[model samples]
Structures are given as structure tokens and as C-alpha cells.
Target chain A: MDVLKFITCGSVDDGKSTLIGRLLWDSEAVSLDIREAIERQRKHNGQETVELALLTDGLRAEREQGITIDVAYKYFTTKKRKFIIADAPGHIQYTRNMITAASNADVAIVLIDARFGVVEQTVRHTLLASLLNLTQIVVAVNKMDLVGYEEAIFEQIKTKYLVLTNRLKLPKVTFIPMSAKNGDNVVTSSENIIWYKGETLLNYLETIPIIPPQTAESRFQVQYVIRPQGSDYRGYAGRIQSGVYRKGDKILVLPSDLPSEIVKIEENLQEVETAIAGQSVVLHLKDNIDISRGDSIVVQGATVEVGSQLQAYLCWFDEKQALTNGARLLLQNGSNTVKVIVQSIDYQLDISTLEKIEVEKATLNAIVKVRLRTAQPIVFDTYNTNRQTGSFVLVHPNNHHTVAAGMIVLNENE
Target chain B: MKINNKSFDYLDALEAEAIYILREVAGQFERPALLFSGGKDSILLVHLALKAFRPGKFPFPLVHIDTGHNFEEVLAFRDYLANTIGEKLIVRKVEDSIQKHRLQDPKGRFPSRNALQTYTLLDTIEEFEFDACIGGARRDEEKARAKERIFSVRDAFGQWNPKAQRPELWHILNGRLDKGENMRVFPISNWTELDVWNYIRRENIMIPSIYRAHLRECVRLESGQLLAVTPHIRLEPTDEIVQLPVRFRTVGDATCTAAVESSATTLEAIIEEVIQARVSERGMTRLDDKLSETAMEDRKKNGYF
Candidate 1:
């Protein structure tokens, strides 16, 4: 069985958590003890429908307030698949939490209330999911019973949602109309909606083909230089982010463009002929090139963009301060962090309408475009090509806190 | 050996993710140590770390906070594994902090040194100045641990502000630590209890024998919990000791950890039992969690890993 990491995003009172609860209950993922605990909390909260949100609301503050704040991860396995749901709060810090949840997610479950007919949060979450590079979108139009289980309403919302996905360039879109509160079209398709000819939410999720991302040229970012005591071995250790490398392949070290041939590839002390993406291995080059930590190596003919200037889209995560021009921060990409300055603040994105508003400063939760200058030339690919090489985090130099996240935009000239 | 371009199943993907995190800890942090308790999770972590960096020796050493009331079998197994692997092992006892006035042992019934182990851990970290401590804490263990970040940052006093954690993205782990602050990295944060058992079954690793069922004298607590009779736990007058076939779900301190009546003896039996078990692994084993609703969260805030 494969694992699917999906996130449920919607505004408050949109049945996001209840749908998750129904899935767990129907799948028997929620055991007797956990169910009893949830029942107790629901009674304490003085609620009716066994407040399934209590299961994911793990914090004391969030539980007491009956609200979810940070991102909470829930794992469940049906017979066919294992699922990891990144359930997050809807209203406040929505973009930040969605980024945290959707960063490594394979799909996004955008819950829309049928009565509301595609609210603002639906658009914002879908856009954020698109921006995070999640290609699969499951638009679960929940609360169908409120609108009398009408298929027309579901079609209207899906049409409008498709218009938004078209703008966001998300190709894979799925729509299922269901009343999450009544278990209609969730795990079992509702008989009331006879016109809808789609699989149930769980069935679709279980059977959907997880299209594998295409592999690009091999990009190995050296995380640590492993040199044991008394033994002279300069092993550049890291997980290969993309493609594959075979022994004796000619590779070029970044920044300096130093050329070297791979003399050996070792995985767990045993020399192997080849190394693929996601396997942590140590590589020994033939020549003693000037290789250090934070340096990346690529196959000889692979094209890697090496520059100091970057056109990037960044999200401000710091509530204490805002991002300003000439703001000095550390730009961390892969395992490397270098001093970087904000060259210019470009424009702010109005998430709801997908419109650009030119702005000079970015506040907390502000997604803006900016140009940055690193102290040293860094190697990167476009974010669309390879996420590992193209993504970076902005760290505060004074406190060493991660303040923002950025995705490098590919310039047409490059 | 095979250059396969493909996705992964549940366990293989989890193993790769954990290995990647272990590599990051070695790459970014200075003076890091793998916090080993000889428990199953820690043992699995050690095995994964072995696979991560083996040709060039593991960059970090293994450190254990000896809670002084561990099972003899577990301690012996711990030493054997460390010696067999030829890795450096550091043992910091809770008695050291008790003598140093930093910690005090409990005297009442259901006395738990679980909370006191934090002081010893912090002291050991300060003594060695370890910038990162790799733990085997999984998110599926408890509610509070569920929301914990993979690379959880602790303050100068080792307090975890769960509300103010740095958002981790992709495979890029940020390991920047200021002076006096450290990180508790959980490589297996994404794995569940069932996943751990499945991996253990597949890998066929050697663990402590205490996990297998055996006839042992146990006391039935007033709260319907079973307590293993150890030298540290003072038996009460009303306590009823009976020889029952039981096995330990988790390997913690002898006094605080509880055992459940079981007949499962082999690794296959344990995996089947785990699949059928209702409560979580810690729900029946850990005595510290039943003290309060937010006991794990409270302890985490006070620098307990």
C-alpha cells in the first residue's frame, strides 16, 4: 500500500474535522479508547455531534477555546493505503499553516460548505495548495444536506473552483458532493444524490493514481563531510535529491565548477555501483577537489543555475517584525545558509482574488515577491523543476529564528 | 545495489525519511548525540543511524540517561549492541543529579523518576555541550507529541514553546542553534506505532527479552493498572502480588513502567498483538501520563524529551 499525505482546508464550521472523523470512524482507525476520550471531551465542551475536532485539537489552549491553532498531523491506514492528514486551522495564519502542511503533501482536500457556495477560505486554501505545488486537488463539497443534497449546487461550486484551478495551473481536480455531517458521499456514496457519478471520498482517495514526479538531473547537496578518526577518507555525505549517479561518472562541483570523477559510492559501509534519489550515501571523488559542506555536485552535463540574484516569492512568518528592503537575513537552501539582503520588495498577493497588489513592506502572513542578493553565489534550479534545490528559508541573523520561506522563480533569460 | 527509480511503500519511505533526518543532524549540528534508551524505538533509530553513516563512522555518539531503575536485561542488551557496533556510548545517571541537588527521587506510592530524568538530561547536555540530541519520539505516541516539530528547538533553559515552533518545510531541516539552546530531533516523527512494529517485523532486529511474555509477580494497582514489582517500588500492605503471564509494551524505568497480561511471546505474536490492541502503547505502560491531561505537554515545556 502507498502513503498519501493530504491536507483538509476550509474555514471554521465548514465540517473539515468532522469529515476526517467520519473517515476514521468508518475505517475503524479510531480505536475504542480514543473514541471514549473524544466522547468525553465532546460532552465537556457541551456539544452535540461528538466534536470530532477534539481529536486533532491537541493543545490545551486550542481545546479550551474550541479552536485549532497550529498544524496537527493524523495518521490512519485503510486496507489499501496509509494516509497522513495535515489538519490545520482555517481562519488565522491560514497561509502559514497551509504551507507547513502542504509542503510535502501529495494532495489537498479543499472542503467547501454547500450553503456558502465556495467561500473566501476555499479560494485562499486552493491557491495556497497550488502555490505549494500540490498537483492533486479533491474539492469535497460538504454539507450537502443543508442544501437538500442538490447536485446542481455541487456542479456550480465545482465549475467555479475549476475556474480558480485553471488560474492556478493545477491540472488534477476532483469533486465529490457530500454532507460530511450525515456520512453522505463520504465513505459511501449517498443515494440521495443519484445524479453524481463519482466514487466516494475514501474510494477515490484510495484508488487515485499517485503520479510519480519526473526525475531530473542528479543534484547531490553535500550536507556533511564525514572524516573518521585515524582514517583518511573525505566522504561527501547527503541524500541524492534527483536523478541517479553511477560510479566513475564525471561530476562538476558548484560555484567553483571544479570537475571530479566519482571514484566510489558507499551505502552503509558497502561500496555500490549506483546511487539513486532519496538514498543517503557517501561519495568519494577521484581527485581531492575543494569540496566542503553546503556545496552541491551535479552530473557533468546537467544544467544548474549559479547566480547571486534571485526573483523569489516569500512568505513572512515573523509576527514580531516585518520584512523590509535591505533587511539582512540568512538564506538557507539545502544544508547551506548564507547572509542575504532583501534587494527589493515587489508585490503582495491578494489571496482571495489572485490579484497582485504592489507593496513596499510585508507583514506577518504576507506573501510577496522580492529580489534577494546572497553574499556568495549559490546554485539552484527553478522551483518547478526540483523543490529541494529551489526552496530556501530566511533566518533572522540576530536571533537565528526562521522568519520566512522562499521559492526561487526561473528567469526567462536563464 | 539496484538503481531503481520508483516510489516507496510505507515502511521504506519512513526509513528513508528518518535516515535523511539523521544525516541532517550530523551535517548541521555540532556535538550531537543519539539519545538511546535501549527501547525498541531507540533501537530502531540506532539501526537507521547505522545505515545512514557506516563506512565513515556515525558522526554522533550514543548517550543514555540511566534512570537507575531499568530492567537488567535491557541494560545488558544495550551494552551488547553498542559494543557490537563499536560505537561510543555515554551513560549519564539520574543519581548524579540527585547527589548534585539538581534532582530528588520520589518517596510516595507510584513514585516516578520519569520527570526527574529531565534534570539529568539537561545536566548531561550542559556537561558535554551537545548542540543537538536525537530522540526516537514519534508523533503518534501522544496528543502533545503529535503537534511537535521534527526538529524541536528548546530555549536556554530547555523549555519547548510548542506554540512558537519554527515551521519546517521540505527536506531542508534548519539546525541553527544559539548558545545554551539545543534541538531535540525526532527522525521518526512521521511514523506510527503500527508502522514501527511492521518495520521491526520486517527487519527482524534483536530487542530486549522483556518485551516477550513471561510469568512475573505483579501488583494490581487501585486504578486497575499492573505494576511490575522492582526493588525501587515499595509494596503496600493492601497490594496483591500474583504471578501472571505478562509482557512490557514499552521499556522505561522499572518503577514507572507497567506490564500487561499477555501470552504473546515471539516477535510475530507481538506484531499481531499490537495490531489488535485497543489503547496506545503508552496508554497502558506509562504511569507518568495518567497524572494529568497535559502531563506530556507540561513535561515537554520543562525540557523533558
Candidate 2:
């Protein structure tokens, strides 16, 4: 079985947690002990039935507040596939948490309350999903039971969501109307909604084809140099960011642009003739070219933009620190961490409006386009082409907190 | 390495991600150490570490914070595995820390050294100035751990502030930390209990004999949980011990790690049991976590792994 990572996001009280709880309950992922604990909590809280949302609220503060504060990862497996659910908080203040969850998710489950139809939070989530390049979007119109299982409400919400998704240019989207609290159309088809005939949420997740972006450029950044003691062996160790590398393949070392031929590829200490993307391997070069960590090894003739100045989209994460022009920070991409200075702030994104707003500085949870100049030239591809090579994080030099996440954006003229 | 198949196996994917995290631990930190507990999870970490850095000696040494109240079988296996790998192993005892600090031992029938293990762990980190401590913690084990970042940063005192955790984006781990602070890296944070067992079966990795079913003298609790009658636990007058075929789902301090009756002598059987088992590994086996609602969260805040 393969793994599929997905995120569930919505406004507060849209039942994102309840929806995940229902899925786990129906899938038998909820253990007996946890079920008992939730039942006990239900009685303590003077509730008639067990509160399924209590399952994901792991922290004491969250349990007391009855809200999810941070992203909680839940895992379950069926015969078809293994699923990783990032149950992110829905509060507007926790948008950074939602962005963190979306960074690695294959699909985005944007929950829309049936009673409220399509809200601003719904539009914001869908827009962020589009920005993160999540091709598959599942618009879960939840709380159908509260709305008397009305077909008109579901249709209206679906239409409203489609308009926003189209505006964002989202390629693939599936709308499912369900009641998370009543266990309708979540793991099983809902009988209350006879007008709906789509597959259950679980079914879609199990059968969804995880199509990874196709890239021809082979890129590998050396994370560490493996030179065992008392041995004449030398190997460049790292995971292949994209494409494949075969023995005897001519490769160019980044920055220095030194030429080398792959003499051997060692995966799990065993010699292999080829290595594909995502596989960690040790590459033995024919010649010692003064290579070390933070150096990239790319297939010769592969188009990789190498430069000191780069234009990218930045998502500010620090609550106290704001992003301004001429701010010096550490840009860490792949295995390389270089000193970088923000040259200019092009525009800040209005998440709800989906419009670019002119700004001098971007605050917390702000997404902005900016230009940066690195201390040294680094090799990268557009984030659209290669997510692994193009994505980076900016770290504060003194406090060492991750300040922002960046995605490289290349101009057509460049 | 050759792409003969279009689809990727979940185990292969988990393994690749784990190896990548291990490499990042080696690449990012100035002094890193792998925390080995002799449990299946940490054993799996050792296996992944070999896959990660084999031609070269592991960039870091294996460190184990021994809570003296540990199973002899596990301790023996820990040493054996470390020796076989031909890597340096550093063992620090909680007993030593307790004695040096004149700390009070937990008073109970099954006095757990779980909480005290953190003191020794933090002391070890300070002693070695290890910037990163790679562990085998999985998010599926507990609630608090579910929200934990892969590259979790801790303060000088080794306290984990869940609310202030740095946002980990994509695979780019932010291992940058100030002096006196360290990172607690969980490479297998995504692997579930069943996934670990399945991977072990697929790789045919050797685990300690305690993992397989064996007849052991255990005191049956009123809650139907079986506590191994180890020397660490204070046997009561009314306690009844019986020999039963039992296996440890998770290897922890002898006093707090409960056993479950099972007849699964093979890895396949263990995997099958894990798939069908209703209770989670922690819910079923970890007696320490049953003490309170936020037991894991509390322990993490006080620097316990």
C-alpha cells in the first residue's frame, strides 16, 4: 500500500474535527481505550452522547477550550492505502498551522457548513489549497443533518465553491455533502440524502490516484560526505530530489559546476546501478572534486537556474517579527543554509480577496512575493516544476526560529 | 533504486523518509546522537541509520538513557546490537543521576522510573553537548506526540513547549537552534504501530526475544492488564503471579511496561495481531500513560522522551 497525506480545514465549528472523528470511528481506527475515554469525558461534560471531537483535542488547553490549537496528525490504513490526516485547526488565527499542513498534503478537504453555504473561510482555504498546488480538492459540505438534509442547500454550496475554485484555477475538485456528527456520507453513503450518489469520503480517499509531479531534471543535494575511517572510499550521500541517476551518468556539481561521472551508487550499503527520486543513496564519483555538504549533483544538460538573486513567494510565520525589505536572514533549502537579504517586497496577498495588495512589510500569516539575494549562488528549479528543490525556509539569525516559508518563482523573461 | 514498478510501497516510502530525516540530523547538527531504547521503534531506527550511513561510520554515537528498572533481555539486546553494528554506544543510568542529585524515587507498587529518565537524558545531552537527539517516537503512539513536529526543538532544560513549536514545512527541517538548546528528532514520527511491525516482517529484522510470545511470570491486574513480575516492581501480599504466554507491545521501564497475552511467535503473527487489535499500543501496554489524561504531554513538558 502507498501513503496519501491529506488535510482537513474549515472555519471554526464547521465540524472538521468531528468529520475526522467520524471517519476514524467508522474505519475502526478508534481504539477501545480511546472510545472509553471519550465516553467517560462525555459523561463528565454532561453530554448525552460521546463527543467525537474530543479525540483530536490532545492537549489540555485544547480540551478545556473545546478547540484544536495545533495540527494533530492521525494515521489509519485500509486494505487499499495508508492515510495520513493532518487535522489542522480552523480558527483564522491558526492559518499558519493550516499552511504547515498543506505543505506536504496530497489533497485538501475543504469543509463547508451546509447551513452557512460558502463562507469566507471556505474561500480562503480553497485559495490556499490552490496556492499550495494541491491538485485534488474535496469540498466536504458538512452538517447536512442540521440543515434537514436539504438538496438545495448542498447544490447552492457546491455552486458557490466551484466558482471560487475556478477563479483560483484549481484543476480537480470533488464535492461531497455529508453530516460528520451523524455519520452520513463520511465512511458510508448517506441514506438521508437520496439526491447525492457520489462515493463516500473514505472511498474517494482510498481510490484517489496520487499523481506526483513529473520532472525530467535529476537533482540531488549532498547532505553529508561518507568517508569511512581507514578506507579509501568516498561517497556523496543524499536523497534524489527529482528524476533518476544511473551509474556512469555524467553529472555537474552546482556552484562550482565541476564535472564528474557516477562510478557507483550505494543504497542501504549495497551497490545499485540506478537510483530514483526519493531514494537515499551514496554516489561514488570518478574524481574527487572538492565536493561537500550543500552541493547539488544534477544530470548534465538538465536546466537548473543557478544564481544569487531569486524571486519567490514568502509566507510569514513569526508572530512578532514582520518581513520588510533589507531584512537579513538564513535561507535554508535542501541541505544548504545561506545568509540571504530581502531585496524588495513586491506585493502581499489578500487571502480572502485573492488580490495582490501593495505593502511595505508583511506581518504574521501574510503571504507576499519578494526578491532575495543569497550570499552565494544556489541551484534551484521553479516551485511549480520541483517542490523539493524549490521550497525553502528562512530562519532568524539570532533567535533561530523559522520565520517564513518560501517557494521559488521564476520570471518568464529570466 | 531502479524504477521497475510505477507504484511505491508504503513501507519503502516510510523508510526513505526516515533515512532522509536521519541524514538531516547528521547534516544539520554539530553534535548529534541517536537515542536507542532497545524497543522495536528504536531498533528500527538503528536499521534505518545503517541504511542512511553505512559506507561511512555513523556520524553520531548511539545514546541510551538507562532507567535501571529495565528488562535484562532488552539491555542485553541493546549491547549486542550496538556491538554488532561496530559503532560507539554511550549508556547513562538514571540511577546515577538520582544518586548524584539526591532525588526521591517514585513511591508506588510499580514505581516507574519513566519520569526520572528525563533527568539522565538531559544530563547526557549536556555532558555531550549533543545538538540533536534522534529518537524513535511515532505520532500514532500518543495524543501529545501527534501534534509534535518532526524536528522538535527543546529549551536548555529540555522542556518541550507544544504551543511554541516551529512550523515544519515540507521536508525542510529547521534544525537551527541557539546554544544550550537541542533538537529532539523523531525520524519515524509518521509510522504507525502496524507499519513498524509490517516493515520488520518485510525486512526480516531481528528483535529481542521479548517481542515474541514467551512464558513469563506476570501479575494480572484488576483492569485485565498484565504486569511482568520483574524485580523492579514491588510485589504485594495479595498479588497472584502466574505463568502465561505474553509479549511486550512496547519495551519500556520494566515497572511500567505491561505485557499482553499472545501466542504470536513470528513477526507475521505480530503484524496480524497489531492490525486486529482494538486498543492502541500505548493504551494497551504503557501503564505510565494511564496515570493521567495528559501523561505524555506532561512528561514531554518536563523533558521526558
Candidate 3:
């Protein structure tokens, strides 16, 4: 079966953890020992019921503060597919944590309180999800029992959320109203909500089609060269970022722009005639060429931008350091790491208002568009076209911390 | 051209991601070591390492922090595998660390060396100046590990500060480190217990015999958990000793690791048992984690891997 990675984000008290706990409990994913452990904890704390949120709050500080401090991953499997949940924090101060969770997710589950409708947190989460290009958006209207399981309340929240989704230009969205605490319309249909006719949250997740973006052009970056002992055997090893490769196909080495033919492909030490995206393999060319790590290999004549200067949208992650113009950092894309300088800050995105504001410097959790100049030419595609090859990370040279995450943006007139 | 249109298997995707991360560890660090224990998780790491750098020798050596309270079966398997692979194996004994530091042994029936193993691991790191250490830690095993980054950065003292972890975005990993700080990389961070078993069955990888069901003398505790009757344990008068078919779900220090009553002689039966299991791996097999709610988090903060 395939895998589906989704994230849950909402305000501090929207019961994102409770929803996930209920899903695991109902699906038989919670073990008996874990259940008994939680039971003991409940009596110690003198709580009326077992707090499902305790399952996700693994850190001591988080438990003491009664809030999720960082993203916690939870896994469960159904007959149809395996699901990976990225349980992100809801507090506004941990926006960077939410971005880290959303970066690799295929779906974004934005939880909203039925009573409060679409709040600022909901808007911000939806905007961030859209910016990350999540394939689908799931708007779960939680705490419906507090609103008396009224369909009108669900409709009102759905309407408000749709306005934000439309403004953000999100393509696919599904709305579900449920009380996570009561298990209403979550894993199974609820008797109280007979008026609503739709698949439950679990069913929707299992059945949603995951269609990867289609690209015919192949791109591969050589991470390590496997040249065994003192023999004539030499191979280029890396993962295919996109497209496919077949034996005897004409390929070109990037930056050097040398041409060769794919004589052999080896996967897991076995020779294969073809390899596709998401598969790690080694390729042997018909003719020996000068190639090393940080080199890109693609089908001959494939269009890939090779330049030293490029524009990208960056999100600052460092709280102690501020990103300023002309700040030198290392930009790592695929297997290649090049020295880069932040040429200029074009604008900063106001997440709540979706407006571009001019900024001279970016601090923690600030999203901005900037221009960067690399010391050497790098091969890449625009972020919208190919996510694997287009995204990069900026690491501070002095402190050795990842300060920003950037997505390459191609100029229209380039 | 015949295009293989079959959708990618989840196992294949996981393996590919793991291999990619392994290659990154080799490419990024100057001196890296694969932290190998005799457990199935680390065994899987070794298997993946072979697939990652086969024709070319491994870029790093395999290092094991021997707790000295380990099962002989597992230690033998560890040596046999290392010898078969023909790679360098470095073993550091926790016994030596305790003696050198003049640490007091715990006063209990089961004197656990679980916490003491950290000193040896840190000493080994300092001795070799390893810039990176690859482990088999999976996020699904515990909650604290779920929040950890793929390339987790530790301070000079080998402490993990959860709040200060860097943001890991996409497949791009940042292995940048200062002179004293080092990184702990987990290539199989996404694989769950069942995924590991499924991959083992698919690949037909051989594991230690203790993972399979065998007759063993176990002392039944009040909590209905089974502890193997080893020399390290001081048996109580009330403890009931019984010989039953059992197997270890996890391999840890003999003083702390527990066993379960099972008859899974083959990998298929083991996979089925894992699917129908009602307890988490650590919940059923580990005694150290039961001490506190945040036991794993606390240990990780203090340099326990």
C-alpha cells in the first residue's frame, strides 16, 4: 500500500491531539500497555477522564506547560493505506515548527472550532499550507458537540473557511464537522449527525487519491561516486529527483555539459533496465567522463536552468540571528552545496493579510522574497515545477545552524 | 519503452529515502560512525548500509557501546555479522567506563547499566572525534524521538535540547556543525515496527536466533511481565520462575530488557504477531522507560542514545 502524510494544525485548544488520539484509539493502534499507562496517569492527575493529549505531549516541558512545543509524528495503518500524522503545535510562537511539519506533508488538516468559526490561526495555517503547495486541504470543524451538532454551525464555519481557501487559491478542499472528544463523525458515522451524508474523516483519508506531479524530463544529482577497488568499475550513485531513466538513453552531465549514454542502471546491487523518480540507483555511462559529487545528470536536451544568480522565496527560522542583505551562507540543493550571498530582500509576506510589505531584514518566522548570488553555477528547476530539485536550505557558516528554507523562483523574462 | 506504472510501494519509498539519507551522511561528514547494536533495528541499518555502499566499502566504521549486561547470543551475532561484512568494528565496554569513572552500581534486583552506557558512547565519540553518528532510532518507537530531527545536533556535552532543534525542511538535510558539536543521524526515522518486520521478511534478512521463539527460564513479575532469569537479576522470594516459549521484541541490556510469550518461529509468524500485538514494542519489552512518563526525553537530553 502507498503512504499518506498529513499534518494537523489549529489554535491552542482546538483538540488536534485529541483528534489524533481518538483516531489511533478507534483504529486499534493504541497498545494495551499504553492504555493502562494513560489510565494510571489519569488517576494521578485527578482528572475525570484520560487525557488523550497526553499521548502526543512527550516532552516534560510540554506536559508542564499543557501545550505542544514541537511537531510529533504518529503512525497508523488501515487496510487501504498507511498514514503518517505530523502533529504540529498550535501556539502562534511555534509557527516555524508548523512550517517544518508542513514541508514534507502531502495533506494539511486545518482544524477549526465550530463556535469560533474561522479565526486568525486558521487563516494563517491555510495560507502557510498553500504556500507549501500541499496537495490537499482538510478543514475539520471540530468541537461540534459544544455547538449541539447543528448543521447550520458547520455550514457557517465551512462558508468562512471557503472564503480564505479561495483567496489563497487552494485547489482541493474537503470539509468535515466532528467532535473529537465525543468521536462524532471521525472514524465512524455518528447517530447525532444523521443530517450530514459524507464519508468519515478516516474514510476520506484512506480514499483520497494521491497523484504525484507528472514531469517527463528526468533529473538526477550524483551524491557519491562508487568506484570499488583497483578495477575498471565506476558508477554514479544518487536518487532520481524526477522523471525516468532507461538503459542506452542519451544523458548529459550538468555544469560540465558533457554528453554520454546510460549503459547500465543498478538498484540495490541488481542491474535494472529502467529507474524512475523516488528510486535510489546507480548509473554507469558507456564512455568514462569526468564527474564527481554535486554534479547533475539529466536526459540530453532537457531544459534545466544553470546559472549563478537566482530568485527565491525564503522563510527565516533563526530566532537569535536576523537575516540581512549581503549575508553570506551556504545554499544546499540536492547533493550540491554552494556559497551564496543574500543579494536583496524584495518583500516580506504578511501571512494574516496576505500582503507584500517591504522589509530590510527578516527575523524569526518571517517569509520573504529575496535574490541570491551563488559562487558557482547550480542546476535547478522552479519550485512550482519540481519540488525535489527546486528547494534549498541556507546554513549559517559561523553558527552552523539552518537559518532559512528557500524555494527557487524563475523570472518570467529570464 | 515499457514503463513500470505500478504505484511505488511504501516499503520501497521508505528504503529509497533511507538509502538517500545514508548517502548524505557519507557525503557530508568527514568522520562518521554507524552505531550498531545487536537489535533488529540496527541489523536493518547494516542491511541498508550494504545496499547503500556495496561495491565501495562503507565510508565509516561500525561502533557498538557494549553494556556488558547483554545476551551472549546477540553478542555472538554482532561479531559474526561484522566479520562477515569485513568492515572495521569498534566495541567499547560500559564496564570499563564505570570502573574508570568510579561510579556506584545501582542497588536493585536488576542493576541496570542502561544509563551508564551513555558515558561510554560519549567517550567513544570523543576518542574518535566522530563528526556524525548514524543510529537506528525510529520516531514511531517513542514520543520524544518523534520530535527529533533526522540530523539531530547535540552540544559539546552531547545533550539534546528539544526547543533548540533546527528546522529540517524537505529532503535537504543540514549537517553543518561546529568544532565540538556532533550530529546524530537516523536514516530509518520514518519506519515503524511493522514496516521493519515487513522489510525484513521481504528481503529475507537473517537475524539473531533470540528473535525467534525458544524455551527460556523467565521470572514472572507482579505486572505480568516476563524477565529472563540471568545472572544479573537478584530474584525475589515471591517471584515465580517458569520455563516457557518466549522471544525478545527488542534487544537491550540483559538487566532491563524483557521477553514475551510467543511461538513465532519464522518471520511470517513474527510479522503476524506484531500486527496483532496490543502493546508497543518498548511498552512490552523495556523496563527502563516505565520509570517515568518522560523517561526517553530525559535520557536523550543527557546523551543517552
lDDT measured at residue B15 in model 1 versus the true structure, 0 to 100: 85
Over B1-305, each residue of candidate 1 has an lDDT whose tens digit, in order, gives 23544335667778878888888898788799999999999999999988887656788899999989898999999999999999999999998889897455788866778888889999989999999999999998888988899999999888999888989887778888888889999999999888888888888888898889999999998767788888888887888988899999899998888899999998888889888988888877888887778889999999999
Write one digit per residue (lDDT tens) for candidate 1, span A180-287: 777888888798888998899999889887644326779898877877778887889888888888999999999889999999998756788887776777899999
Model 3 lDDT per residue over A118-208, tens place: 9988988888888777859888999999998999999988888888888887886899889888888889898889888988999999988
Candidate with more favorable, higher lDDT: 1 or 2: 2
Per-model RMSD to reference: 2.2, 1.5, 1.7
Candidate 2 CAPRI level: medium
Runs of candidate 1 exceeding 4 Å displacement: A42-48, A412-414, B1-8, B102-104
Candidate 1 versus truth, CA RMSD in Å, comes to 2.2
DockQ of each: 0.66, 0.80, 0.79
lDDT score for residue A319 of model 2? 94
Number of the candidate with higher lDDT, 2 or 3: 3
